[model samples]
Target chain A: MTINEIQDQIIEEFAQFGDWMERYEYLIDLGRSLGPFDERHKTPEYLIEGCQSKVWLYPSFEEGIITFTADSDALITRGIVALLVRVFSGRTPAEIVDARIYFIEKIGLRENLSPTRSNGLLAMMKQMRLYALAYKTKQEHS
Target chain B: MKLAKSIEEIRSDFPILSTKAYGKPLVYLDNGATTQKPLQVIKLLEELYRTTNANVHRGVHYLSDMVSERYEAARETVRAFINAGAREEIIFTAGTTASINAVAFSFGERYVREGDEIVISGMEHHANIVPWQMLCERKKAKLKVIPFSDAGVLDLEAYRSLLSERTRIVAVTHVSNVLGTINPVKEIVAEAHRHGIPVLIDGAQGIQHGMVDVTDFDCDFYVFSGHKVYGPNGIGVLYGKAEVLNELPPYQGGGDMVANVTFEKTTYNVLPFKFEAGTTNFTGAIGLAAALDYISLLGREAVTEREQALLARATTGLSAIEGLRIYGTAPQKVSLISFLPGAIHQYDAGMILDKMGIAVRTGTHCAQPLMGRYGITGNIRASIAFYNTEDEVDALVKGVRKVTEMFA
Candidate 1:
């Protein structure tokens, strides 16, 4: 699905939930569905910086599209990473590069997340985009 | 000795104190984390932003001059608050963390060498511990920690043994945030000086509880946050000894801190300005000064007595509760309590209390090392301030009792 379609579906699913707790549970379940990541992908180099929770994201390119699999020690943060991955993963490098996903405001994360968590989320997004940019550059070169 | 008015009258000054959560009035007991600002502090900030707002020290406009005057006056107020030698010794920074980082970056970089020792106590806030660790890592200096007893009091003998000729600096907290043990800073300073090592006291938790005269303590440096002392957030004071401040390099390079700057060598400004490098929190500093004025008018002795009474009430009340274990039962304590209940997560208790409109802090409180020392992941910290009352303590106890009963 397109990023906007996925976001709309997630929002619709969230809207069906009565309260924050149910929405949170849905988010966590979504994260669980992303399945497990490998041990090699769990190193400090791939670890998202400045988060109270430990989160790791690893990206790979397939036919000029970037796909990412991420994991986190914290359930909520894992869910957050999952949301980010859903929005950006499997998208072409150009699409990912053009996307200015307001993930924080959209997910209603800022009010719940601490300043550290918010900064960490920003850093994670930046890293993902950087990865996408590199992939795009490499694709052009090839 | 009763003040002219009851606590109800004083409570009116704080809007948050009267706020209701889940059908109950908010009984705020998390002053150690940060105190609720008074209406006066709030109004002062609003007024500064609404009426007279401008950048300080650079512009030649009228509003700028007015802002500069208020900002400098705040410095003078802080100087008098701590009884520093002069206004030039007080450097305005973001908060205690920034203030300490300034010291660590400047002095720690210059003086500390490989194999030199930097000593700190077990109960320091992360702000005090991490900067020194970073400094030690960079300079290849060894960081020595002064061990504490199981009771959470500093083992002075252990502290003494840790100090040596190689000890370049001794950084300690004036009061323990978790334990509430007020350290004998004067004694620590004297001991460190005997070894010819300068000391920096993290007074972030101290300034509100009691008086701190930098001259009386004779320490090399002192730091505290305005927010913790009923002032506005994002403003902190760094008081350095004149001679020591003169020697250290500037922390940040920017507009006000420099006298003249070219691409080549930069000539820095005077003492306080040299450290303060960016556009400061002018409103916050002014509001903090107003807070100081308010606090001074309230009288330190009155504030201290009221806090002591509140602590006594809380400890006695909590002692009566079953299965509740209180940490930091040191003989000398300020107005705070950290405790755990049998088979209850601290976060759960905190959430429960929040639901009942009783605000208390739960978690490591940015003092994870101290939590590790106590062999607990986290605890519920109920800290009191002078403005708090026995009634609030009653409410907190009642809330905890409800939680215990529900869990049981």
Candidate 2:
């Protein structure tokens, strides 16, 4: 979905809920439906630093496109990572590298994430972008 | 036990107890944030300003002398409250954060060297964590953290292993604000001192729950906020061993900390003044003294018993709820509980409770490392003070049940 469409859908879905609890449940369910991740891919290398929950993200480069699969021990944190993945995953290396997805500010996620989790999100984004940058460099060299 | 005074009489002392919030009686559970002051403390502040509103220890006038006497008397009160060896050892600051940072800046600057390690526990508040991290970064020192067990108690074995020849300092909280786990500080101090390493106990949460005798604990430094102990804001105490205070360099330079000033060289003042540095919070110090008087009248033992009873009731009530998980199951804890419902976010739960006129703290409570250790982003924290009642606990339980029913 386009960025605007995704934003509109998320807002509409959130508006249907009465309170934060319902919204939170809906968000977790949305995370669960973002396709299955390969269990074999979970490792120390994919770990996101500073998160309260244990979150793992693994990225793959296939034909210049970057695809990532992520999981978290906590349901809400998993939902947060899922949201992030939906925004950046399956895009070209250049697109992923250049995209300034303001997901945190747009969704008001920072207020929800603890200071540590917020730092973890930043760390995860940094790592993901680094992976894309490496792929772009390799493509240029080849 | 015969009652010296009833809760009704004691309740009258606090003006905020009668105030309403959101069209309901204010049920404040955010005592951990900052406590509401009693009439005694407020009266003390008012009297200080009304009768003797003068800068202390400098002027020759009667008001200045009275102000100085009151201010110094407050220092003595703090010294007795913490059972410090000497009144001169008590240096006032802008609260626990300032007190911890003073230790970090002075002791951490002078002693910590490259390749040396500073040990801290996983349950420390950010006030205790960030200062040490910054110190380590600046001095090229290594930071070692003592892990916590699943029960929220500090892993004593891991702590022993983390301590070695390179260890210069060990700073830990006397009580975990988030987990409500009262640490074995006396044991930790003894262990650290065996290797001649100095330990600073962050007593911001400790001073409220029970009595703290620095001599008994044998800690090099102990710090607490006045506001946490029913005192005024902008005031806290840092009690260091006389020898330790003498050894450390001055943290800040200003009016009171100076002995002599010259173009070429400047000499600093003696013991507490050398560290105090500024005009200081004169009124806050007086209010703090009044707060100490109030607590003493109630008696520490009485306050502790009352708080423990309230905690027991709260925990029992909260545990009865289905699918409710209470964090910090340590054998030793203060009157605080952090919990999460089976399928509800902590924030959502907190919002629901808030609507019912019961206030609670949600999120990490500034102990991010501890939260990470527990594998939860956050939890709802209900911290009880001595003034809290059984009826409040009942209300809290009912509120939590409502949230659970709504979510379920």
Which tens-of-lDDT digit does each residue in B1-408 have in candidate 2? 323567887888998987786587878888888888989999888888889899978899999999999999999999998899999899999899999999999998789899999999999999999999999998999999999987888999999999999999999999999888999999999999999999999999999988799999999999989999999999999999999999999989889899999989999999889998879999999899999889888888888888889999999999999999998889999999989988677755775677678989877888887888878788899999888889999999998998887656
* Residue B132, candidate 2: alpha-carbon lDDT: 94
For candidate 1, list the clashing residue pairs, or say none.
none
Itemize residue pairs with steric clashes in candidate 2. none
TM-score of 1: 0.77
Could you tell me how far off, in angstroms, the CA of residue B394 lies in candidate 1 after the best superposition?
0.8
lDDT of 2 at B262: 97
- Per-prediction TM-score: 0.77, 0.78
Alpha-carbon runs more than 4 Å astray in model 1: A1-142, B1-5
> B330-375 in candidate 1: lDDT tens per residue?
8888999999776565754665677678899877888989998977
